[model samples]
Target: MSAKRPVRRATPLRKPVAGTPAWVMPVAVVAGIAVLIAAFWVIHWYTTPLPPKPLSQDTTTVVVSMMTGLPASEFDAVGQGTANNLIKPVSGTKLLGSTGKPEVFYLGAEYCPFCAAERWPLIIALSRFGTFTGLQTTTSSSTDVYPNTMTFTFRKAQYTSQYIDFRAVETTDRDQNPLQTPSTSEQKLVSQYNIAGSIPFVDFANQYVFTGATYSPDTITGMSWQAVAGTLQQPDSTQAKAIIGSANLITAAVCKITGDQPATVCASATIQNLEKTLK
Candidate 1:
């Protein structure tokens, strides 16, 4: 009887709402931003152009340059001093004493820091052999000690590649990747010179090998090729003596091979006296 007045079903209760969270909007915004950023990165990676890979290490490239001759100040200072180190080559001896072509073999990479320094002296020395064409003096690697550096000069000139051959074995191509992975001949050449597996190894007529500068990499600290190059123009300066010293050693080795034709400064009494020890 009292019965059925019934069992009214209790309505489902709603969760009590605490005050709207103060950080809700901020947290949602942050998550949305994170998603957008990730999406952007993926899109950029897919859209951006990737660096190219080299064809082969054996491939040869024409050496080019825009710098014609040593500047006046450099000519007078570094050039003259460096030239003094060169002794007159023996009357009949050819550039490469015995084996291999009479080539100026260059081993270096675009990313090298020392190569950044050594290239100037090399350019100055090689200019004596022939004119460099289509050479661009660009900066070293971005991931290297330096960042996006300045441009190097590029121009074309003529020379006798027969007697004074310029075999530039870029160990790595422009993209900072290994290019010419030193052949048996190259390895042998480097070992004979007592140089480490590093760049900017210059072989003059196959007789001399210049490893790196006397001073450490900290010597001419710069963030670009321009800064590094600018330092080379003053090779004879007091601050540059260490570099000049190393350059002299290279010049001496080159001169000895080239019959001292370039009149390198390493041929000077100071450097020659030092060479006497090697002999």
Candidate 2:
């Protein structure tokens, strides 16, 4: 009687769906391939962006030699061709530096095309007063305007000089990821001077400030490192005119901070003339 009272209830089985739709698998496969391809691109971007690749000795040699070796004639010839008015004064600013010397503070990112253009002259100008080591070569962000412009990155770089102190920061890599951090004081200068949040922000000891490219990135947009370096020696080349010209102008700004010292550079007829234009 107990057993009969405990009669088990039958469990109902759910009906199974019919054969899978033919389009489902193919669509899924295509979607999976798309995802893989996208992931590949994200992970395997073309240029080596981070931990910047050190410039080749040959490249460095050429860069140093060409940048440093340029006859003052080339600079005199270029004579601030297109850099006119690119650098402007930031008034009522305190001079920033260390060790009884004026500091040249530079802020830029590797992805910045304007910064890319500006670095050429900055380096050339700095090289005249000092020496740079650990310089790395890279291109601007491939997706940015005037994309893939061959240039140098200041990350992992060092500048030494008796005339002045050089401070540079590559705030981000080509991927737009943080790479270097500027000092709190440097950030203060940036905040004060860089209202536009632009790249290639250069402060010549807070006396003169340049906020953008002195010349167009297009000047060397399609050129390779070697091509850019080679063309720089050509006084008639547009690249030289823009880059070297800008260097001459920048050199003049630095001279003001240095009290027109190193008569070799500050005394040069071209630099002296450009210095007059700084104000």
- For each candidate in turn, the TM-score is 0.53, 0.79
Best by lDDT: 2
lDDT of each: 0.50, 0.84
- Model 1 TM-score relative to the real fold: 0.53
Query: Best candidate, TM-score-wise?
Result: 2
Candidate 2 backbone clash number: 0
Show model 1 residue runs off by greater than 4 Å: 1-68, 71-76, 79-101, 147-163, 191-195, 214-249, 262-279
Residues 136-232 of candidate 2: C-alpha lDDT, one tens digit per residue: 7888887788888888887888888999998888989987998889888788888888888787889988888988888899999877777888988
| Model 2 misplaced stretches (Cα beyond 4 Å) | 1-55
Error of model 2, residue 215, in angstroms:
0.3
Q: Write the per-residue lDDT of candidate 1 for residues 1-279, one digit (tens) a residue.
A: 355566789999999888978999999999999999999989877864332232121221221222224343443344224222322122222334233546666777766766655655566555655555545555555455533333332222223433366666566644577656666876776666644565566666544444554344545544334334445546555434544444444545555555555444444565455455334
Listed per candidate, the RMSD to the true structure in angstroms reads 10.1, 9.1
- Can you give the lDDT of residue 81 in candidate 1? 42
Lowest-lDDT window of 10 residues in candidate 2?
Answer: 46-55
Clashes of each: 29, 0
